[model samples]
Target: MGWRRSRSSEPHADLRLLIERFGWAVEHVRVPRRSTGTPSSYTVGLTAAGHPEIVVLGLPAPVAQDFLNAVAEQVRAGGSYRPGQRTGEFTDEDGPVVFLRVEDTGGLASARDVYGSVEALQLVWPDSTGRLPWQPGYRNAPGVQPLLGQVP
Candidate 1:
């Protein structure tokens, strides 16, 4: 009954969905032209409200293009991260965006999973000593379904 996603149709679909649901002011920065050869990598940026930029670097041309598309989609959808939500905020304005970093892992296999079992949930604050925080388990609402799984 709530926002359940079947499997994602393409690579990075889930990431794009996350960005679409949670980012503000997403953009693609073009690589400078090189006379002798074409640029091999691209950069994509996403900024949530009250947070610094989250940059994805060294993306392949196709993926970079997809990032651009994701930006457009986010804009059209008017998506934004809400303040006070666990996964939404950074430790500070300059704190890390805590991306899934698709390039580091292989890719998103299904809509339900990220890098095996790592689902991007609300971000909890670090301990008093300043250690990095990790993602918490996600729960579906009573009348809502996750995009990946069926409700019983």
Candidate 2:
């Protein structure tokens, strides 16, 4: 299917298109919020069982990598994440899952750039879980660490 664009008044059209392109059904698109550099902050809601959500925050170029790495490590280790006071427990009945946080230029967003960011997230889709959503059968077969090597 081709990329779907939201109405002119709607925001995060590119993010919506990218999320859909990844094959994960989009459940909701929260209204964009005001940001410093970009016109608005975007969040793409997913229909996954665990209520997964993806938000592209407007962070400075320098700390973006560190932030991504820190979040990845936290999620991998099953620790409480301080981002907005939400615990970083990435999991559901299927197994542990991660919320893909991608960094992008704090400049104006374009369909091309959003697509690129989504692509980057796919490269690390499962984070440290080492399992995809479709691999639940295999993941539960035997000798599998459901929580990506972390207990509970």
Candidate 3:
């Protein structure tokens, strides 16, 4: 059976089905370039499956969704990530992706709203030159990738 819809009119029925079948669901958020924030995506229901929810910042909505899905798939397959861990499993033209522990969940309101007080990680990808945002020669603008946690 489907869960009751929330006041915000989110697709609880669809999300429920997804979580039941896939162990989690990805929520892609697309923010306009002119907006104060950049595009991001996060996972829902991962905590229930014994894994921390995941988030990726500064990517296009589709790419972010795909990345989150890949991470979720790996998690379901028994792969795990920790803060400051770097893995080549998910990579761009530049290099491996890094995982950062989300010390603050304020930016993940949607994921929190779905699963209260869930632990989360941010998947940080490198720039064209394989430089992370904190490293020199990083390509993206400062606002493009707002880190939700401290750089490890």
Candidate 4:
């Protein structure tokens, strides 16, 4: 069970469990924010009990604010693209935030099932206070779960 995570994301308790359970290789999970340009979406990968789950991680207060700011700029400028993927006048420091996507064999539905077990695992954050850092995901988003029924 091994996977990757982005360096800049963060995760909550339940999310952490799903990450560990699935053995995702990503460094972190990307949180969603209201984007003015293109419709913004986020996701995470999971593999619980040899299955995968795509639980959409929630946006933290600080992270969400940053994304919203970028969205505003894009809307006013008539731009399109996510803050992390876009640039020029309207861009967020947001890096390549890891997103849950469909795998070859399992697709994404299997990942969703893994998240369903998150509650039972009682996942814990790497930090004692459980407060995600500015870069986040590393301590929190690394284990965050994605919403899989549909990438809302």
Candidate 5:
């Protein structure tokens, strides 16, 4: 499927696609605010259990990677990562889910709280220019995917 053109419009539509494809849910209400940038991103409760995960600060891959790498470095220094859970809106409803986080990014003080710190990593994947677009209608976009009725 294609990416969304503008997250502000029909943001949930793109989020739904992400859930269907990436198994990640984006909560509309919990979207972070008061960011250092426009079209900002807040910590998306990466996990269904709300244990803290990746920071969803609207940013491109390179910039996000920098934040991630920095946090990763912090993790390597003495933190850790795990399959943690966080509470969030799933398919527009509350539910449990999972995602990956740095475990810690605030240096030694938060070393033990790697997962929480991971929530604080402050990374994001933003497309401010609407450079990409969610399929005009996902139904029209076709590609390799779950095969038709093969008996689950």
Candidate 6:
């Protein structure tokens, strides 16, 4: 199927097209260090495929894109996940990553605008020393990887 650009003022025609073709689309937001927040990326359209959308914080745009893409692929292939679960599918070298329910959707404006009240999860990765953000001596700053949901 092909996507026709709608006349609405929404500027996500490209995102819609990508979702139609690939089951999901990744959106990477890069904020300068001087800004209030670090870089983040999220998936759009996963809700349409019967899966909750995903978000990754504090990673570079390219890395986040690849990570989200891999997750989307697995979800589309009948894989299931839940908040507080750990998996090594994405980063086996760094050990398993944790998934948490995103209680706040304010940062996922694109997914909300497209799907309207969609469920989302945060894929939290660990530091180089295999310590999660909640653990002591984690490398990144607090603001660098803000959690939008409760710790599981």
Runs off by more than 4 Å, candidate 5 = 1-8, 25-45, 49-51, 56-62, 65-152
Candidate 2 local Cα displacement, residue 83, angstroms: 7.8
Best by lDDT: 6
RMSD (Cα, Å) of model 1 = 17.8
Per-residue CA lDDT of model 6 for 50-101, tens digit only, reads 8889999988877888888888889999987899999988885665788999
Worst 10 residues of 5 by lDDT: 143-152
Task: Give the winner by TM-score: 2 or 4.
Answer: 4
lDDT of 2 at 76: 36
Q: So what's the TM-score on candidate 6?
A: 0.89
Off by over 4 Å in 6: 1-10
Model 2 misplaced stretches (Cα beyond 4 Å): 1-56, 82-152
Q: Regarding TM-score, does 2 or 5 come out ahead?
A: 5
Worst 10 residues of 6 by lDDT: 1-10
Residue-wise C-alpha lDDT for candidate 3, range 45-78, written one tens digit per residue: 7888788899888887677777888888889888
Report how far off residue 49 is in candidate 6 (Å).
Answer: 1.2
Candidate 5 per-residue C-alpha lDDT over 1-152 given as tens digits, one digit per residue, 9 for 90 to 100:
22212355765555545545533332222224554333322222233333343443334434443444443343435543444333222212332222334444442222223233334332312123321123232232122111111111
Residue range 48-102, candidate 2, lDDT tens digits: 2122223323233223333333443443355333212323343333334343323
Model 5 reaches what TM-score against the true structure? 0.27
Which runs in model 4 stand beyond 4 Å of their true positions? 1-56, 82-94, 97-152
How big is the RMSD of model 2?
15.8
Q: Which ten residues in a row are the worst by lDDT in model 4?
A: 118-127
TM-score of each candidate structure, all chains considered together: 0.23, 0.23, 0.87, 0.25, 0.27, 0.89
